[model samples]
Target: MITGVYSMTLCDIGNTSFHFLENEHQFKVSVEDTIEHLNLKEPIYYISVNKDGEKKLLRKFPNAINIEDKIVLKSNYATTLGVDRALGCYGYSDAIIVDFGSAITVDIIAHNNHLGGFILPGVEKLKEIYPNISQKLTFDYIEKINLHTIPTTTNEAISYAINAMIVEPIKINYQRYNLPLIITGEHGKKFLNYFNNVFYEPNLIFKNMKLLLEMEK
Candidate 1:
């Protein structure tokens, strides 16, 4: 177990940003920013999916500890599963964890075992696809969409398709597993409209990181 939980600094490096939790304070910095600029002075326990960012962090901050290998969980998922997704499902016995970051990952944990999951392009990434297809398809981001309604306008059509693509599959799995939905990551809250018995946990990964640290000892 951690000797001083309150003083522990945890960092989660993603493709787009570096998320830091120090004490009870949480903040983020862009991956493009210089690592030395943070002026961090504590021993940091971190997990990262961004190879470039991880390298820079380790090179710049000798105090930064890479704890990806320390996370011990029984998963039926292939060896290639992302650590973020694995940790997201760590403490849950039965749940569908949908993480919306640079990519959307849906992982299932049943009876404390990971049953594998699927991935899709995230909101921002999906938005870029239509414009590539045709400039006329370009539209402003829509925060809310009605999947039941047939879209009439170009913008509504794009929004409907995006929401349908992301939500429909998860809804199918939710019905199959009959598990509580756990939503997390940067864009996770935007999906609250589509499900019942759902939870929004922005700090799910960080919470599990602490659990993993304890288990490591």
Candidate 2:
């Protein structure tokens, strides 16, 4: 147990941001800011995809537990499997996890065995590419999109295409696996209406961190 802090800070360091949750409060801080601002004396539990950022975090909090080293994944996952994906699927029965962030991940876990997954470019990346590919296809609007119908404009087309791309693969996986679907990540809830069988658990990764702490004791 940490000597001074009342609760542990759990961080999920991704490609673009560092997400922190302590007790019930959560916030997103830049990796650099987190390294500079986080209290070094407090206990920290973190899972990271960025090696250099992880090193920075470790340097600041030498006692912090890297969640990757502590959690045991019972599966055939390669070394490249992300800790975020693992954390999202942990402590579940039979489930398929779809995380929509910098990149989209759809992973399966059954009977505690992480059964491999697929990765695709995220919607933001597609939006970036679509503009460069064709100036005529550009959509300058930044309004909330509803993907319930066919597109009549460039913005809607882009929204429709990316959402369809994300949804179709997930549908295929769900049909094949026939398991409960768990969706988590920055954009998980936005696609909730499109997916009928999905359970949106925004705090999955943090819950995984908590479970790790409990198991360690």
Candidate 3:
């Protein structure tokens, strides 16, 4: 639509880090590098950022798009909309999405591709509560979420709490809805032990982002 070739620079900044993808190229930069680059732009630009990093990145890129402060207008209905669209395109319906990143989000997509249910708090969130609870306890949790009845120490107790807080609710919802579960995040492996019908797709978010970006233009 332009006179010259214009590449899209999409920076998906999460609670943990920034994922910089430039058009079709894989321009991966760390959090520090990204911050420095943002500051270099004279006129600055609108940058999509997380609620946590909004203030910081904005201070750097004064004119950057603060999507964190403003809600994005979406073709799909909800935050889970991107995943729903992609999964539907791939002919995947009746599935549960367990995204375990900063937040463990358990979202259920109905057979008709509508969002049917939801839950939260994956492994990381549980581990956050551990160190404060006891000396031996640290931010350690399984990469998976499953059944472990015998949680001996405070660390184990936190895991158990996370399981009960996150996984068990999903279990209940899955039981209620009767859809298969699909997990994606830093801690997908831990889920392998507990669930039989679980598929781990690490780039669910990336794929969704790509889809949403496409729809934007």
When summed lDDT is taken over every stretch of 10 residues in candidate 2, the lowest stretch is 140-149
* lDDT of all predictions: 0.87, 0.81, 0.55
- Point out the worst 10-residue segment of candidate 3 by lDDT: 66-75
Q: Write the per-residue lDDT of candidate 2 for residues 163-216, one digit (tens) a residue.
A: 788888898888888999888888878788777767998888888889877887
C-alpha TM-score for every candidate = 0.93, 0.88, 0.60
Model 3: residues >4 Å from true position, as ranges? 1-9, 22-34, 38-93, 111-113, 116-119, 131-149, 152-155, 212-217
Residues 21-77 of candidate 3: C-alpha lDDT, one tens digit per residue: 554543333454446544232322223335555566666655655322222322234
Candidate 2 — which residues are off by over 4 angstroms? 1-6, 32-34, 140-148
Distance (Å) between predicted and true CA of 212, model 2? 1.7
**Comparison by TM-score, 2 against 3, better one:** 2
Candidate 2 is scored at a TM of: 0.88
At residue 128, give the lDDT of candidate 2. Answer: 86
